[model samples]
Target: MLEPEMVAFVERTKSLYPSDRAVSTVVEQRAMYERLAAAFTPPLPDGVRTHDAPFTSPDGHTFMLRLYAPFERERSSGTVLYFHGGGFVVGSLASHDLITARIAADTGLCVIAVDYRLAPEHPAPAAHDDCLAVTRAALDGRLPFGPLPASLQLAGDSAGATLAASVAMRLRDEGVKGVRGLALVYPMLGVEPQSPARETEADAPMLTLADVRRYSALYWGDQAGNEADGADSGMRASVSARVAWTIPLEASRYDGLPPTLAIGVEHDPLRDDARLFAERIRAAGGQAHAPVGKGLVHGSWRALATSPGVQWMHGEVCRFLSDRAAE
Candidate 1:
């Protein structure tokens, strides 16, 4: 059964977004997403300090990075590199300002939000490379994050989570150390459009299978239908396999990864993506915990202040980050 609040939330979204509306171009879809984000994103809490900096990707592309720090903290609990979700196409640091602020304040952690390039213009390696570059910079203590963090972690929501997972894989392969953990919220891990949750939540309120396919097409580029013959697509598979990080679930290795926490929403098609990821991590001898928000829908991070269940879930994430950072 759907929660009454979620049902009403869907209705309100429909009134503004109109399910019948059609978006043919990436520009249109991006505009629609920006509108929704602006309308629904909650206000950032008070006592959180924010600033922006410029980061140049290893590929020489420069982008803006936003940092959120808890107010008046004598020392931070830790630092986290946060990637925002928009199917790798639409989100910005501004769209997720509330989430980062709350995380910084709640966990007493310094959160750095990356404004990576979007797809259908830049595509797969574009987003992935940008995130990996930022992570590398952070790990090397070159990102101007004040002082070296006591511990560092990677985090993201949806597509951002995918980036974090992939980056973690690369870090593991490179023998990089000091990454405390990863926190993935409703991540989009692979091209499994026929997953069970996809079948059951075909028309989930906030996100749908069609929406997933659209985002996949945008992010994965021409590999949208090359799943069966990964060899025929040559570059897509080769680049994605250079390191097990590209498609984390299909990675050749999952051992030696830092602790992980994956959170999923019950009505989301990607719910099992989180479940299976955690299961695999544990199978590979890494600590992992996945919690599902029953009676919730995708994109509920926007409801952090409005929904009691989401608030509790956010608290759980804070607690997890705090515990792992302390360890």
Candidate 2:
């Protein structure tokens, strides 16, 4: 079934495209992202409206956010802070259009996808800090949407997944509460890339070791407050790369953090990363699990319009959010 699905999936993806791609080197990685982005033109559902608006990051680079909302539906379960997964360098809200809308529609939630600065450009703390700033401001004092539920959720795929954890982690560190849940879709949580998922799916068709290396190479260093200098990142030969850019959830205790949902793909390289993080979240005295797409591949949710895995994931994420909202 997976093989047949992949065959059909590739056959159908002959024309989709993404709007942005991370590019540490405009000559290589960036160009690769552009091609992938150009091939990701997913069609969103009928009531979903996409918009670009300015957001202020703590560092003042004029951050932006992309929102996916059901224009006619005034009702929402809650607002979701989304981050796109592109190995932290490529991937914009556009890359995950189908997934984002499916999330909003299925969960009955409004999704605000943070256009956080990517790696090799706005690396390390910049992306992390921007996400933190947006989340904190979004949920401050007054009700976020004119007296609606002020609760929020952190949602991201791949690189965005890392930021999701980083954002929640920072918030937890800062004593900020009220997050309903954290949903990481095949997240890239490790800086060293030694997860079994990478070894197991070393040659998975949809994603590969090359993709990982490229993504890592793109996100290989810390670009803290250096986007304007035209600086290129330099990889460190250190013992604590994890401390700089990785989300070591395995070491964190979920004291006041919200419940978490870690999604993985059987045929993707980041599967193990998701599994490991989820287990740690549970160990930390919070709830976490890979809601039922274990047989699928990375970014399966992006194919929600075409695959059973994605559709099932859509429903599962909503149920998770709603169930947690009740808790």
TM-score each candidate.
0.92, 0.81
Per-candidate Cα lDDT values, in order, are: 0.82, 0.66
- Candidate 2 has what TM-score? 0.81
Q: Model 1 clash pairs?
A: none
> Model 1 lDDT vs. the true structure?
0.82
lDDT of 1 at 2: 67
Candidate 1 off by > 4 Å = 20-22, 224-244
For TM-score, the strongest prediction is 1
After aligning candidate 2 to the native by TM-score, how far in Å is the CA of 326 from where it should be?
5.0
User: What is the C-alpha lDDT profile of model 1 across 134-208, one tens digit per residue?
Assistant: 888888888855674658899999999999999998888888887898999988888654368989988888888
Top lDDT model = 1
